[model samples]
Target: MSLIARTGPQEYECRVGVLDSLTEKLRVRGITKVLIIHGTDSWDKAKNYLTQLMDSDITLEFALFNGECTHEEVDRIVGLISQTQAEAVIGVGGGKLMDAVKFAADKSSGVESVLIPTLASNCAPWTPLSVMYTAEGVCLGFVIHTKQVNLLVIEPNLLLDAPVDYFVAGIADTLAKWYESDVVLSRPEYQTNALLLLSRAAALNCRDSIVNYGLQAVKDIQNQTLTPAFIQVSETIIAVSGLVGGLGDGYSRSTVAHAVHDKLTAFPETHTFLHGEKVGYGIMVQLAIEENWAEIDRLAVFYESLNLPKTLADLNLSDLTEEQLGEVAAKVAVDPILLQSQYRVSKEVIQGGMRSLENYLATTV
Candidate 1:
């Protein structure tokens, strides 16, 4: 048995106005020169929170994140760090920007990294891995960094004005923790492992907390209200969901649900969909593969309420030709995460699961 769990950042703080301490944190660490990489719009949202840091004596270099966390983007940020001789890099945006900064910092020898997420889109701020994609937005898997984030500061006030769709997508992505981890953790062999048990508990907490608070949190963001439910759901998404993979290691990291996501990303028509929206549909596909129609029915109601994708039509892939659909199935059939789960499935099995899920939905509608 092998276990590799990179729990989270060395230091994490989530509260309103917590960013006031950032400059001092850096000063004490002796990080005099820093690189600030941010998204265009995200910078506008987050800049006001960093007034103190901007006024500090520490030297700063700024770079606009190029959107995708591609290898080229990592190389560019790495080059910027080298040229500027930045002692640390700070990412202020959504997941892509944070992932790119972490990857670049890892490649930059002794450079430290800090994250201040402007969007509650995913666990990118808490996790020590970066999900890489092509320039055109195709998924190219992810890389786990050896060095953890030096700090993660979540200014809930900054996220209050974030787009509602991204917040909803975050809920969908975080919910995948339970559905994905249970697929492997429920096995008899994993039942006795202490760490996996903790991972399982954390994953279950993600599901329960999201179910209990998700809708209210949605209303919270829609009205720009900072309520208790909103804070609860936000922490659940970024912190607790992170522990599913953090404690369970590779065993609960991902499975068929994420595999289905990788396959769907190959289609350009699906490019407009968010990561969690795609994974929401992948959950149904995974359930269909296991012939768990009941669970799919239950989740379909929740997914509909959240406006998450539930069908090929929802993903704009209903017009795909049989050959194209077959290609997706074939790719999913051999997905690394799927294979790693020890569940053998053929391309035909995947295609049938898709068809079955559609047929079931047709009956429900």
Candidate 2:
């Protein structure tokens, strides 16, 4: 049998003030000598919550990163962990910081880490994979070091301070979970209870929050009010995106959506667009290719109405030539997941979809 079964730990605690009981949990798991990995943010906003969790004897160290998870940042964090002989890592910040901890802790002498998410941007906390980058912003490998997560500590009050755009993008990312998964999981060899559970949940709730909340979710962000819909979106990103998306056993996400995003990223003009925004557009493009016209048009209105990028210009890439898009398509061709998985996704087909998306976006606005 595999060393780590594709299952969560026997016990998990997803709660507010998770840190108040954290010391006991760590002691229960035999974890000591914790490292706090932080990103650039307002510590004051979360100071009280963290202070309550700190035990008198727990040795703490700070490993800092600016906004990005660069190679240098990882090195600094890892260097600190290596020098300190810490037993576990506690990542505190938004998704990027959590992702960095996930990447570094596994490589730091096999120490497990706890993810304390301060914002519900994406489900980076729940996943075993870390999306890493070079110092120069080149996309590197999706670091899949540890298949285990020790804890996910979330306090809704802490999230009330977050910028609503993070939550909005998070919802967009989760929406793709169901749509992309539906295509990928249909492959006979890879479908499973876990994948079905995740994809179905994601699909069902894709539009529910927005439909129910309307502009209230956005207003909640403006007012810093944690509405019921906001909580659902946050939970989806932190819980479903990380755990469910990570545990999609043998399932493929190499669908038309992500492929189109990959191709779009080839051009520098589209670089400023947020990850979720790109994926949202990608999902629309994928639906168009799959000829799910009903869903595609509906999604198009939502994406456009929200001032999200529907065409290249919206991504600030109105001037990109077709050659740049082709280059992106070629670069996307390199991911091994495209060919090695149970589902068959052709490079040519993906390129065609990208071209179709580009054409559609050109005419969309």
Candidate 3:
């Protein structure tokens, strides 16, 4: 038996003016009627690039993505798809919008999905999974779907206008591909698994590309410039990062870093933090658990340069009660995703990791 990797969408394209072909592309796929689910702000920005879809004879029904990939949102999208008899569903926005459409389309008898990401925030546009959340924005894990997206097209112009904070958060999120996967992939037993090896290579690319070009990419986004570094970093975040989990499956899927992020979401104070920002802090915690101080030191410099969260204070958890901190550590210690790594961490160890990271950061200063 061989490993089956759902690496990305069936048809993926990234370039300037790509959405200009949106109508013809859908038409060729036998998709005439579509339910376009989008965020208010992102859809407004994406509208300029989708002139073809608007002018074409295709029947279009528009629905607003309610800012979360909650079950209610997915159900609403699915209901719209059924009522409109849409042949396809197009998602135009950030990760949550795309995830809602993807999951809704799958539930709606596997209707074709076309994703247009307005923000280079995460791999939701590329991966065959949806990171589900509550209506209140708490993490509820994720669900891997049976079908891949029918099409995913990225227009650099649209992403160039995205908020720089999301771009930086995307970089931090993409960097986790390396930190999360290497823990398990570097083991001896999986040495000969070719697909996992490919995943390992992709994970390394995600790390190196982001580290080398992330700052410049942030600057490019800030200046609204479509430079080579911007394109490379954006694609690395959206496409290359997908390969880490797609190719390796559970082995390279989120480990401790993401589990930490998930746990932190339970705190209301951390609600203001972006997904990747918390994961950035989680990376330091994961390193502390492994007692890998050298790598932690290396990453701390990068974290500081990007204004990524490296300590509890950075995540606004500096004043968290001892009981509250213990609760978080206990929850994270038992997270199912944490088992993916070779580590066997306990609640005390998790708490110690947090303290060690804070102590280490203090020493660095």
Candidate 4:
């Protein structure tokens, strides 16, 4: 029998003022010299908290991320680690920077890594995978590492400073965990799988938590108050959402939703939209493909409240001709991940779903 790897972060802490304890956390793990990879803007905001670490005995170095998590960037960071002889890497920024640091640390043998998300954008910090993109910002693929993060520190205070849009996008992305995974796990063949059972519970938690508390969470984020609702929703996004993928393994991996997001990346016009925004629309498309109109209507209402993308126009693909959409459909249909769905998907089906979603949106509006 093949061995299944069920691993998560060695240590996970979510609380206010957790950033102050970062250096000591590393020290306890015997991590001495550390390389910190962060975004320019995020670093500017976090410098004050980071200053506290300098007082500790741990040696530190800094690397500025260029906004894309490409293989080249990972290699460059790995090179820096080699030269500096950094024992560990601390990623203190958003999803892209965290992914870059994670990939680099995984590639560099014997080096451990920690993630401190400056924005609750995606579950890049907790998962053992990096969503790779081209330098030009096109989605290439994702790389699965052999291990989960060494530590995940989520300081609610730090997250509160992030733009409200990031939190909304995160909600949309986390919600996809349920819509995307539920269809596959509901299949009879996989019902007995223990991992899928755990994954289903996690996915449900993501959906329910967001549905019950997401609106209030967004409000709290706008007010810069870390209320109970906000904390619950944020953890649902970062921690519980990661568990959906971690426990489910390949069976619960994203299906049509992420496939559409990947194909949408090929268009520069769609670049302005966040990852979750595109996936939010992709969820509608997936529902359309399944002929689940009621669920689509329910989600459309929720997405409208959150300002998530609901139509091609919302994704900045309003002017796209049928031929252009067909090109995107072709890509999505061919993606290997789409096959993970319990039902077969085709280019024609994707195109039809796009039309159906557009029609539904038109009538509703």
Candidate 5:
């Protein structure tokens, strides 16, 4: 019999003050010695809560994250974990740090990992994949590990302290889960796959939650008040959005939107944009490629509402000549991941889509 392995974190906890109980959680997991891999800024913000862990019997060590989730960094941390003989790895910070720790722990057998995210920026903590990047911050691709995370702890109050842009970027990223996957799921060959059906429902749920509660959630964040709406949206971003990929498997993989984001990373100027912001514009390009003008209009209104990128100008690529933009389209057309789409995509198609989007934006403005 063929066996299918489904992976997820062994334990997950989300609450307002969960950080204060990190020691007890580790104790229950029988992790007596741990090495913490975290970003410098996040470590500073979380020092107060982290200090209490040291008061317990658990042996703790800290390593400042060097900032990217590259193979070299993973290898370096793997060496540190071996030298420290840590029973477990505690990744405390944003997505990149969590990815590094997860990749390192997965690469080194017998090493367990616990993720504590300081922002609700992406589903990196809940997912089993690490997005590997070049040392220069260019996207190489992602790596899927055989094992899932040991534990995931999310403190909502800690997330509240992150910049508003991170939260907005997260919303944009989560919304793409629906748009990107629904197109693939609608294909005839995938229509009856039970797992994909569940994933489709999850993606729909993500969309509904964001559509119904996103604005209020943004308002709550601006006001610095954690309301029911804010909490729901945060969980939707981190948890519900993750379930889409977790259940969908390969069939639900991101299509054109993320592929465009990866290609845009080739330009240093686009590096200033957040991951989700780039994906936001990518969604627009994908819609244009499908020739879905009405849907594009609706999404454009929503993008404006959330200050998401709706045009090339918003993506900081408006200054590029048509030839330069064509080069980007050619690169995106050839991305191996984008080729997995059920529909046939080509350089000419992507370039045409970009031109159409630009013309549409000009008329609307």
Candidate 6:
């Protein structure tokens, strides 16, 4: 596990008309040339946005991520910046691509970064942290440096068109921090009000957004009605969900919510789902283990209603058979690690949690 790095808000904005703020932020930084990093899945949309920007005096170059990023992709983005000497690097897309850009910026020299998230799946755009992937595209671990993004642009008008699953997954991922951060806050060893404040701020910001507009965001996506829902999601997924939640909880210690995400990823068949979808279910399982079934279950049903995974098989996970509980427990039993959780966590504790999860899935809708 990587050490936690507490980051300041630097700056946060969630008002209407945020996309328009991007141009001025760049100009103030004296950035004349920009290198854009985006994903191939959203290549056309990325191009459209880039074209709009090109109409301005700013020189622009774009690199579409072919698929999952590799060291080569990071190197390529860095190499492009070195060769082009672009004043800044801007990343557009989901969390993974953002992580790629942020890491490359850290490894590079002098070039600052701006983030424009096309989706709100994870708070990657808001945090200074980055997750590095191996050549094969597995998340090797995280890259924790003090580097922070200068500008983050979230246009709900843009994200409202992406699949509803992305919005749902974003909530799922954001919601995990509500539980995980609290778990960290409980630990006697890792006590810091400053840290907890950041974590709780992220949690509450997301919780409030979810309570108010989370359903609206989902309903808007389902109905394809983008007006109010787009506006809400722009803040919920992009601003509140991405930046505030990211700065608050992301830079803090993540307990079971993320650990479960990691362990579940070991089963490659589960790759079809988004990270937040898997993580949402992980939060459910964590809630069950902690014996706080009622609170977590209420949200799990929301996820179920949204068509997120509620069962082990739903995650495409079959390797974690009933017989494998002991091994899973032992593997997860890292001392001071599990202790940081909101509740006491042990091998027996996790086994009980898994058992409860199995039971919960057996009965719930």
For residue 48, give model 2's deviation from the true position in Å.
3.2
Give candidate 4's error at residue 172 in angstroms.
Answer: 0.4
Question: Model 4: residues >4 Å from true position, as ranges?
Answer: 1-3, 340-343
Residues 234-331, candidate 3: write the lDDT tens digits. 99999999988899988888888899999888888889999999999999999998999999988888888889999899888889877888898999
> How much is 58 displaced in model 6, in angstroms?
2.4
Error of 3 at 261 (Å): 0.4
Instruction: Report the C-alpha displacement of residue 275, candidate 1, in angstroms.
Output: 0.9
Q: Write the per-residue lDDT of candidate 4 for residues 237-330, one digit (tens) a residue.
A: 8999999888887667688889999999999998988888888889899999899999988888899899999899998889999998899998
Report backbone clashes per prediction: 0, 0, 0, 0, 0, 1
Candidate 6's C-alpha runs over 4 A off are 1-24, 135-137, 186-195, 227-230, 241-252, 323-325, 335-344
State the C-alpha lDDT per candidate: 0.90, 0.65, 0.89, 0.87, 0.85, 0.68
Model 2 lDDT-worst window of ten: 1-10
Ranking by lDDT: 1, 3, 4, 5, 6, 2
Candidate 1 has its poorest 10 consecutive residues by lDDT at: 335-344
Clash pairs for candidate 5? none
lDDT (tens digit, per residue) of candidate 5 on 142-193:
8988898998988787787788898899998998898888888777777777
Between prediction 3 and prediction 5, the one with superior lDDT is 3
Best by TM-score: 1
Q: Which candidate, 3 or 5, would have the higher TM-score against the true structure?
A: 3
Question: Whole-model lDDT for model 1 versus the true structure?
Answer: 0.90
Q: Which pairs in model 3 have colliding backbones?
A: none
TM-score of 4: 0.97
TM-score of 2: 0.86
Worst 10 residues of 6 by lDDT: 1-10
TM-scores for the candidates: 0.98, 0.86, 0.97, 0.97, 0.95, 0.86
**Regions of candidate 3 where Cα sits further than 4 Å from its true position:** 1-4, 340-343
The residue pairs that clash in candidate 1, if any, are: none
